[model samples]
Target chain A: MSIFETIRFALRGLVANKLRSGLTVLGILIGVGAVILLVAVGNGSAKVIEESIESLGTNTLTISSGGFGRQSSTSTSSTSLTVELATALADQSAAPHVKTVSPVVTSSSLAATYEDTDVTVGSFIGTHPDYATASNFSIKSGAMFTTDDVNDHSKVVVLGSTVAEGLFGTVDPLGQQINVSGKLFTVIGVLAEKGSSGLSDPNDLAIAPLSAVQESLTGYGSLSQILVQAVSADDIDTAQAEVTSILNEKLGVTSTSSSTPYRIMNQAELLETRTSNAKTFTTLLGAVAAISLLVGGIGITNIMMVTVTERTREIGIRKALGAPKRTVLNQFLVEATVLSVIGGLLGVAGAVIGSQFTIMGTKPVIVPSSVLLALGVSVGIGLFFGSYPASRAASLRPIEALRYE
Target chain B: MSAHRANRPVLDVRNAKKIYGSGEATVVALAGVSLTVHRGEYVAIMGSSGSGKSTLMNILGCLDIPTTGRYLLDGVDVSKLNDRQLALVRNRRIGFVFQSFNLIPRTTALANVELPMAYAGVRSAERKRRAHAALDLVGLADRADHEPNQLSGGQQQRVAVARALVTAPALVLADEPTGNLDTQSTADVLAVLDSLNQSGRTIVLITHEDDVAMHAKRVIRLVDGKIVSDQRNGHLAASRSAMLRDAYSTAVYR
Candidate 1:
């Protein structure tokens, strides 16, 4: 028989059993839809992480006073990263690649009150004004506390967007005073809103001059960490090397010792690590979705087998009319393929529509390749799963089939 | 009819034998039975249950291969043909009408008739035109769009007859074509077959009914896988020739 006639026959056969055929299609639809949607969610989360990391200036490096494993234990007492070390690293003659160095001391949780409202700040940080530039924090109103304010030990603080909203609500607090652990400080600026990255909320902290915070809340202790910005993205490596050498000389540590009391984390390296981690997560999601697709393929096999058995007499009639075995096989195979292809197309539409809304706090980004792969696999599933039943129908002896009840 | 017999036998079988099972459980369905049928002939093979008439019918219809035999249809040695080639032979050279009508369910009467032609790779337009013509010949032209289930038993049988004749094969094998029909429906189906035979289409009707067998010009009775009698009804042949002469004279006068 002609291919056109065979396809028509197959379609008519499916139409004759509408409920069964529709259920089979629905199985495949769920499989394909899950694959595309879940993978898109994985991709979306990865994009969110990458953007957040990029927001923390790609040329910036965080210098903290701890090393990994054994190195951290032995070197903890030998040399502590202090404000003096931060100052020396900032010298123009010694470190040309280093653009700005901000020494930061953090008080983890401190209750701050404005009038009757009191809220516990997630992070109360003491740092130079340069911390604002390095961390990409922009002032919404009023200006950042200047270097002169740090030298004078001014009792001034900048509220992050979340902190400001909690303490003052709609009321403007540009010049209002807020109490931090019983110490009153004027709010000179409010940081612009930054949405929470997966790790922590960046807009739930307050910033102040290092000298004022150390004198009041923390006393003269080792600086919490150092924030260093390289002059440009390409200068990050050279700047890190310069800072290492300066710290090594001042702290009396030899380069050959293999242990240091400090560690510098490169923002670019962190981004690469996070992106790869996200890719692994996406792959895991894809694998899970693929299992459902396999089950859907199995569903096709089950339905096709039933159809072949039910139509044995019809097959015999066709054979008696002189239809070759190949024609019979093609008819059943085409029927199965049509079912899956329709389901796959609907799945693509479903995934595309489902991705439009945010899912689990992340807007899903559809991967083009996942859509194509799901469709291709569904078609392949139809052909692969369809073969067994079709061949069974084809191999049936005409006399026996005709004799069948 | 004599001129057609002189040209070539439409079907020729030499000692066709069919066996079932092996050794201890062996049973012979067709035992060294030989038969020949010519163009423009209507032959009926009659037998009770287990008389091997069905076996011989199957072999003659190309639906089964004999254990040992040389069978030719339209001068083609079908005994040596493979499954694929046998299917082609069945499509081009033989038409079958089963007892149950065997029309594909859910298909229109027209498409049922067009089936054999479709397997022969005929184009859609030509298939449709020929299918409609065949249905018209069976007096089912108005019911061409009806499915098999929608047609009555007699109409369904007539549709099967239309499907059988649409291919214009060397032989039309009808296996108990009226077995499922009422008396009136049987008459209607048999009348369609008579008209087809009158138009010079070869027919082989397999039935146990003596009345049905009497409709054919030649009757072969099988007993226990062996043919006991092969005779021609002289009276029927003589009357059919008279009818043909009247048709010829009318054509000449017109």
Candidate 2:
């Protein structure tokens, strides 16, 4: 028989049992859809993390106290990061790759009030003007506090977008005074809105001049952390090395000591770690979805077996009519393949449409390779699972099959 | 008898034997049976249950191979043919009509009739034309679009007969063709077979009913896997020839 005629026969067989065929298709549909949708969600979350990390600037490095080591009583005082160390790191001749250094001190859960509005700030940060450049924070209205304001110990603060909206609503707080821990400070600027990263909200904090904040709220303790920017992306490693060696010398700590009290984190290294972690997550999700696809393939095998058994007499009739074994095998194999192919195409459509909306605060980003792999696997499943049942039908003897009830 | 001998033998069976099991609990379905049927002959094989008639019918239809001995159909030694070649032989040389009218469910009568021709690799247009003509011969021309379930038992059997003849095979084997039909429907099916035989088509009917076997020109009775009698129905043959002559004369007069 011709290929076209075989395909027609297969289609007729499928149509004869529409409900069973539809259910089989639905099984494959869910599997393919799950594969594409889950993988897309995984990839999307990874992309979100990468973008947030990239926004922090690849050329920047953060030097913070409290490393992954046992703290020693003798080194506690020397391990504290201070403005003196920050100044030393800022010296061009000592660390030529270090473009800027901003010393930061944070006071968590600070109560601030403005007239009738009262809100608790997540982080009240005290840093120099270069903190804006180091942290990639751009001012939306008004200007950042200048170096002169830090030198003069001005009581000025910049509100993050979320904090500003919470304290002032629609009021312009650029020049208005807000009370922070019983100290009145003028709002010099409002930072532009930045969407929250999955781990934390970046837009719910406030920044102030380091000297005034230290004098009022912190009382001149050691700086919380130091933000350092490299001259270029390629200089981040060199800049980190320079900072590490200088801090070691200034604090009288050995470079090879296992109990070092300070840690230098490169943004690039953090980015690599995060991206690899996301890759692992995507693979995990794909594996889970692959299991469902395999189940769907088994569903095909189950349905085909049932169909072969149910149509045994019809197969006998065809055999008696001179149909070759290959023809019967092809007919059934084609039927299974058509079922899975239809389900796969519909699943791709479902994934595309589902990806258009945000899922769990992450916009799904469909990976083209995942889509192609899913479709290819679905088709392969049809043929692989379909072969056994089709062969069983083909191998049936004409007399025995006709004798079957 | 001389004229029948002059015709080429369509079926040549030389001491065909069929054994069921190897050792204990063995059953012999056919025991050293040898028979020859010529072209354009209407032969009926009759036997009670377990008389080996069904086994011989299966062998003759090419649905089963003989355990020992040679059987040839249309001059081909089907005993030695492989499964694929046997399937081809069955498709191009033999037509089968089962007692149950095994039409593929949910398929139109026309497609059912075209099945054999399709397996023979006939083109779609030619298959359709020949299928329609065969259905017309069985008086089911207007029921071509009906499914098997939609047709009555008699009509369904007639459709099976059409399917059996559409391929113009060397021999038509009917296994209890009227066993499932009522008396009236049996008469209708037998009439169609008689007309087909009159038009020079070879037919082999397997039945246990003496009344059904009476319609055939020759009857072979089997008992315990052995043929007990083989005789010509001389009176039926004469009446059938007279009927054919009367119809021919009427056609000429018209």
Candidate 3:
């Protein structure tokens, strides 16, 4: 018989058993839906991590002194890291893979004011002129603080986009003065909006000359964290190792135990780890969902076998009417394929709809390739598991089947 | 006899033998049985249970192969044909009706009638036309859209007859076609078969009922895997009684 005719007959057979076919379709639907939803959430989180890494600059690394363990208060300790050590690490001769180093000193919950209006600063940071290049920030209007400013301890500051908008209300704040921590500092430049980088919100902080924040607000010798930029993304590991050893030597930490009091984080490695973690989560979820598809395939085989047994006499009738074995086989196989395909289509629709809602603070993003793969796998499950029952139907002897009653 | 009897017989078997089981459980269903049926002849083979009548019908319908025999169907050596080739012969040259009126359930009368044509790879439009005509022949044209369950027993049996005739086979094989029907339904089915035979359609019917066998122009009686009598229906009453007496004596002696 022609394939189209066989398909028509198979459709009729499925229709004849509506509840059974519907249940089978629901099984496959849940399987395919789970795969799509899990993969979408995985890809969504991966994309978010990738964007954060890009914002942080892949070639950058952060060095924090005496903070290897969670219990370490070395960030607040005055003896671990100083401006002089940061200046030494910034030298190309000391760390050849290093491109630039910016020493940071942060004071949180600082209130800034311009005339009568004021905005609460999330963070007030102190750093050198190379801070723009190290952290991928750029001056939008005015210039960054000069080396002379650092040496002279000039009371000049660069406001981030959020800080500038809040203090001056869209007015050019470059020539304005703002009082930070009860001290006045000139706004030399406004930094461009760089969004959050998982470390901090660059758009909500302010930058000042390192000497000024250390002398005026913090009144401490220790640096908060040092931002280091490698010459290229490939040099991040080399730059991180150089920064780690340089800090260990400066802090008088011994190298015999391979234990350094400093922690170095390479943005590239962090990005890779986060992305791989997302992929692992996706694969685990996909595997669990795939088991359902396998079970659905087994369900199909079971139903088809039951169908074959139940219709033994009908099969005998068809065989007696001159149906070839191939025809009988094709009929059942096509029935199974139709079931899976329809279920897959419904699953795709469900996933697409379900992706619009957020689950656990992350919205799913339906990926076209994963959708295609899920559909392909479901169809494959149908064909792979449908073969046994189809062949059983085909191999039935007309004489015995007719006598089966 | 028709002129086709002198030509190639519609079906011919030479010493057909069928055996079931083996060793201590061995049972020979058909032993050295031979027969020839000509074109356009209506014949019935009557036997009690275990008489091998069903085995002979299966062989005649190409549903089973004889263990030791040469059976020619529509002039082809069906005994030597492979399974696939035999299926083709059954599709193209033979049509079958069963005692249960085995029309596929949940299928309309028309689709059931078109089933054999579908297997023969006939086009949809032509198959539909031929199926409708066949249903009309059995006076079921108006009930073409009804499912088997929706039809009465007599109507369902007529639909089965229509399905068998739709393929225009070389011969029709009916195994107790009226076995499950009431008296009126049985009469209705018999009238349909009688008309088809009168229209020169070749039919081979297997039954244990003397009334059913009496409708055929020729009757063959089987006793314990052997045909003890083969004759025209005018002397069926006498021949059936003699055959039964001989079979009873043989059974008692054994």
Best by TM-score: 1
| Candidate 1 local lDDT, A159-220, one digit each (tens) | 99989999999999899999999999999999998755567889999999999999999988
User: Which of 1 and 3 is ahead in DockQ?
Assistant: 1
For candidate 1, the per-residue lDDT at B44 reads: 92
- Poorest lDDT segment (10 consecutive residues) of candidate 3 chain B: B245-254
Tens digit of lDDT per residue, candidate 1, span B1-254?
34443357778998999999999999999899999887667899999999999989888988888999889887788988988998888888788899999999888999899989989999999999999998999999999999999999999999999999888777899999999999999999999988877777778999999988888989999999999999997476664574455344324422
Task: Report, for all candidates in order, the number of backbone clashes.
Answer: 0, 0, 0
Native-referenced Cα lDDT, model 3: 0.86
Error of 2 at B146 (Å): 1.2
i-RMSD per candidate, Å: 0.9, 0.6, 0.6
Model 2 whole-model lDDT (C-alpha atoms)? 0.91
Q: Which residue pairs clash within candidate 1?
A: none
A121-218 per-residue lDDT for model 3 (tens digits): 99898888888877778889998989899989999999889999999986889889999878999999998888565656668989898889989999
- Residue-level lDDT tens digits of model 2 in A167-231: 99999998999999999999989999875556678988999999999999998999889999999
By descending TM-score, how would the candidates be arranged? 1, 2, 3
How does candidate 1 score on lDDT?
A: 0.90
lDDT of each: 0.90, 0.91, 0.86
- From the highest lDDT down, the ranking of the candidates is 2, 1, 3
Listed models, DockQ each: 0.71, 0.71, 0.68
